[model samples]
Target: MNFEYSFEKISCKDVENFEKIRNVTLPYDYKQFLLLNNGGKPIKRRFQSKDGKITSSLMMYFPISESVEISLDEKYKIYSIGKIVPSNFLPIGIDPADSLICLSVSGNDIGKVYFCDMDYFEEDNELKKEFISLISNSFTEFTGSLYIPE
Candidate 1:
């Protein structure tokens, strides 16, 4: 739950502004994380499936700079447009391969983290639950799951 390289610290007000503009209620733990580190490179960057049969490495957590100033790629809104990312889900980070690391913002799955593989779809093009892999049941768990790859 630590980042060796992180953006400038942000206040709770900044997080509130972000949520208001984005129209989504962020998880409390995630909001606290934002206040600690807006975004950055994690110390432990890898995580794996339950059986360790599948593994993925994180690139960076997307900054909460939408309320400030940043590029489209750095902002979560760009990926959420046109429902490309799916409703009630937001891009919070990315894997090394540029796939999305998402967070659920509504329903019973609120605060849960998921992986959206960019190269999974063949046709249909619509994002579905089957295509999204549940990484953890909460943002705290997701951050806690990060580990150093062997």
Candidate 2:
């Protein structure tokens, strides 16, 4: 079962909902802390849907969580800018059915296995190229060196 994943557009309004989920799921305050430290910049380069709703958001921040080294057994590889950073301020989301129920996860290192309720994205080569073109300054090939189970 090979599943493909693509990025999606996220808006400022989506940030508010994401914040609510983060506050509840995370042990410590992630939203406020991220704002103070990294100015809370959202990764809007890659997007799937164009409904002005962010189906997913990948944020970059200073390494705060314990760093996990990539090894032979590692499954995912996340190549961040500059250095190998661990972001404790992770991506959180509000369950569409139950807004009260918030699901959050942190420390999604490279070669990590994730089993969750994320809507699988179909890969569009053209769209991906467009996104890469848009963010020429921050483009890094996801070298398929690691076997990421689809």
Best by lDDT: 1
Residues 10-88, model 2: lDDT tens digits? 3434445543633323323433333333222232312222232333222222212222232101111221111121222
Pairs that collide in candidate 1 are: none
Pairs in steric clash, model 2: 7-47, 7-48, 8-47, 8-48, 75-111, 76-110, 76-111
lDDT by residue for model 1 over 14-117, one digit each (tens)? 78887787788999998888788777889898987554545798888878664534422344656675466777787888787878888888888899888887
lDDT against true structure, model 2: 0.24
Cα misplacement distance, residue 132 of candidate 2 (Å): 26
- List the global CA lDDT of all models: 0.76, 0.24
